[model samples]
Target: MARNLSTNTGSQAVGGRRHTVGRLVHYLLASPWRVIVMVLAGMTAVAMIVIGPKVMGEATNVLFEGLLGSMLVKMGAKPGTSKQAVVTYLQSRGQDKFARMIDSMNVQVGVGIDWGRFGTILMFVIGIYLISILVRLVQNFLMTRLVSDAVYTMRRQIEDKLDRLPLQYFDRTPRGEVMSRTTNDIDNISGTLQQILGELLFSVFSIIGAFIMMLTISPLLTLIAFIIIPVMALCAGVILKKTQPQFTRQWIRTGQVNSHVEEMFSGHMVVRAFGHQGKAEEEFEERNQELYQASFKASFFSALVTPMSTFFGNLSFVIVVIIGGVHVLNGSMSLGGLQAFTQYTRQASQPIGQLASMGTMLQSSLASCRRVFDFLDEAEEVPDIEHPDHLGQETGGKVEGHVRFDHVRFSYDPAEPLIKDLSIEAKPGQTIAIVGPTGAGKTTLVNLLMRFYEIQGGRITIDGVDTSRVTRHDLRSHFGMVLQDTWLFDGTVRDNLLYGLDEGQTIPEQTMIDGAKATHVDEFIRKLPQGYDTVLNEDSSELSQGERQLMTICRAFLSDPDILILDEATSSVDTRTELLVQQAMNTLRKGRTSFVIAHRLSTIRDADLILVVNHGSVVEQGTHDQLLERGGAYASLYNSQFTKGEED
Candidate 1:
């Protein structure tokens, strides 16, 4: 369960929270058509929002004027009072400012609350608001599609980049780190875009629309609204500066935490076998604590933006209210106009707050974007040659499998050479047993042959065709490898064995049966509840070690590659199973050029050529019997292995 995708759950993901600019620009540039449509929709919505407040304000004006007229008549003011008469009376009382507001309204005292006119204004206000809602829905829908498409393409690019990267990248990097970048980091990018992009677009337009509305109704109040803008900007700038790095560190820590958890849980059996569970837990706690600190600092600082914006917005609202109220009483502004201005004040301020609050998600999103882009921009494996030699083309498509390493020079680290000036030749169908002590470049030899690492000097050729001249896929296709560490995936037994087949190609049922019977696993397979259909868990937990090794060997047999590279293929099995596997391997090697990296001397006693390797060079080479008779390096290694086995 600890390895269930991530160490953290969905909520835990929330807890952890670029090339940055160039990559984002590129990502957005990838979808110009959708973005253009979204922009258009956004403008339409903002237009409706801007118009709705004004229309509603007019409705307020109609209602207020009708009510005022009815009240004046009730107070025994003259019915059907002339507009000019009303203004002249207010002027005479030194209420000259109030006279202007009355002159602007069509308030005839005898008209008394014109219900038909008020109803018309109310209907228009409703229609205006309904249009705003519809336009916003369209904008929201477009935004959702754009985010989905961007992340979808991002995931695909990451996957392709992984496939093109050199094997050394994987060797040096943690599996969980790679997976975290591909999944959690990409998922984080998706979430941030969804949570932030739509709101960001809407907020920008809202601020613009509201500001325009405020200016149209009252410039003095509009000026007061934006007085708080610089304060909000300065505070947001300070908060954003602190939160960005924390977000970056938080995601990096999340990856580290995931790597530790994945490694421990995937190898939990080994940890238990070695009794190191406490050490694992201690390491995990240390990494987890680091992640918590990073996530907390990021979220804490980002949380400041909201409250800061709210304070400024409220301050702006209060100032606008006091000033606008005076204007209304002075008759320079209508009650309806003041009402609209206040709504616009809040509208503009709220979006500024929203923009500030968005800083948290924006920083988190930028961090994820940079990580993804970094991965995408990694040094890829050297591209395959433009005009590569098809490895078997020189041999009439029936490769002779005469592999030769010609004075090869190589190193894992440039200064620390692992293999130097090594040369060896295997004739067609010859079994060349490579015998060496630990770290004597035995596995390194096979890795070079497979082009896992290219040689710095000299050439490796398969059937006289230089391997470097051919594509890796073409070069490796001729070889079937069964290394000491047998690997199987979560798949059916049948699928595992046939994994090496080309797409849409499958082995004959009879071929599978014969190979299983020859490898002495036929009875074992038949005894299983579902035979080959039985699904395997990680590393084929249901099978014994010997059974798993046999399954891998069986897989190599199914591949029927031209050359076989066996790294003590039967080493995991018991003596009886080893003998049975040896017989099958002997039969398997008859016409196939085999390179056996042998540890046990008995396994290679019948090899056509036995090369004794020590300190990155071949110290002795001969037929197995000749080496023993000559009492050279080969003889010493052979005698030592049997002696060690007997002592054990």
Candidate 2:
């Protein structure tokens, strides 16, 4: 029912992180214009930041000079300080370096700190930071929107990719892993980006701005600081690199834990029925333990960044103080310059630590990114042949359902072939029933017919056109399926019945009533509180297996498919429900080509042709009477069921 609704409307994962950079680049490069504007704004903000410390240092220099000059006036120096007099006084006291620096001072011996100059410097600093803040705000706002959009589109792409992946992917991969990539991982990417977006900009620009400020203040101090900074970064980088593998393992283990939990929940009833609760719990505990280890390692390594950063920042601070103090005493550079240089060292190391620490979140996000990208990069199903619609056009918008498998071959594993050189033909409007033991590839045959799994070799054609030539959509448009495991969308009974209808396509109420009545489901459906409008979803207490099966058959009836596949549809229901739908099933099959895979030999006794399949190849093929006369595999299968029936 769910599939038909989609019809009406509409790879294995490789290495986890392969081509991650390339794919990320592709996503970003697609939006170069927006990126350029954000980058420019960020750079402007950084410039203002780097300039603030310099202006602040100038204010400190002015204040210090004023304090010294007022003291000199108090000691009875003249109103206007003479540089020569101060130099002579200092030299006599053996303070040659301080005397030399006094030669360049603009201080008046009698005056105090110039409040106007200090206030102007303060305003300049404020203006610089204000501009930086404004630019930063604009950049962050735009960046958040842009990243959100990219992740949004990434989700859509993953969704579309899900549609194109082959059935084998889902068969091989656990449901929780698939869900992790689609929901959890992608969400992690979005969340991590949001959390660090501002910090990422601030850390990077602060490091750059601080380094430039330090160089302008004291190149020698800047040199010593730069050496210590890289060592700090290097240690952080090394530890952070270790975190990547840990984080990768963490997420992988998370997927495992989710898979185990989801599986246990989905089959909890069966687990309890079989009394396997202890085993399930044990398995979950094991997976949880693995996840705990990985998470602990990632977090532990990531946490080291802060203390390591602090340690290096302090070491650099001490070195700068000693070296810069010497330069200050020599009067080669002012005390204010050394003070500014000290501030720059702090800023640089702090941001460097932040940037290094980000690797933790960044690595975790990248781990999630690798999973998502790996999913997106999975090998897609083979593309449909060009001009797929040409076949439909040739068929006059109708398919007669003449399907043939010509020497087809297939295998789940290449080393061990399953269906080898099997050939079959079903003329238009023929009912072909397939009987097979378990693991005999019975469902696989029909799956091949529907192009669910492409044949490893040979060609399957419908109405003399290659099935591979048409798009799966156009090909499947001609067919409808009812499997043993019936499915319905989480919607109303009416919704499930009309699932495969096109966007606005609708059936007349009478037409629906007639289809339901034909399937003998009308009475049961009408008995429901809401009748056909009843909601059918997970935990559908109102629905039963028999009701679900009947509804799927009704859905197939509504699809009006030229070809139909009923795989054990009647095998599971109670005898009474089977009998009710049997007449409707007969009517539905009339004049349509159908393939029925059934274990109940009695059910397919009247098929136009029956193929007895064992170990993936047909052991016998003939009508009921002919196969019975031969007394081979078919006769053995029939006799066992018949004897079982008589004994019952």
RMSD after CA superposition, every candidate? 6.0, 7.1
What are the per-residue Cα lDDT tens digits for candidate 2 across 544-588? 877888888999988788898999989757888787777787888
lDDT of 1 by residue, 1-648 (tens): 767656556435444332465667667667788888888888888888778778778878878888878876785668888878888887888887778878777788866666787788778877877887888788788888888888888988887897789878889999888888899999998888888887898889989999888888888878888987998899998899799889999999999999998999888999999999999999999999999999999999999898899888889989988999888888788899988888888888888888888877889888888788778988987788999888778566778888898999998898888788999999999999999888999888998898887789999998888989888888888889998998999988899888877679887899998988988878898888899899988867679988999999998988888999999898999988888899999998989999999888888889999988887889889998799889888878777667755734
| TM-score of model 1 (CA atoms) | 0.94
For model 2, the run of ten residues with the poorest summed lDDT: 9-18
Clashes of 1: 1
Which model scores highest in lDDT? 1
Clashing pairs in 1: 18-370
Best by TM-score: 1
CA lDDT of every candidate:
0.85, 0.84
For each candidate, give its TM-score against the true structure: 0.94, 0.92
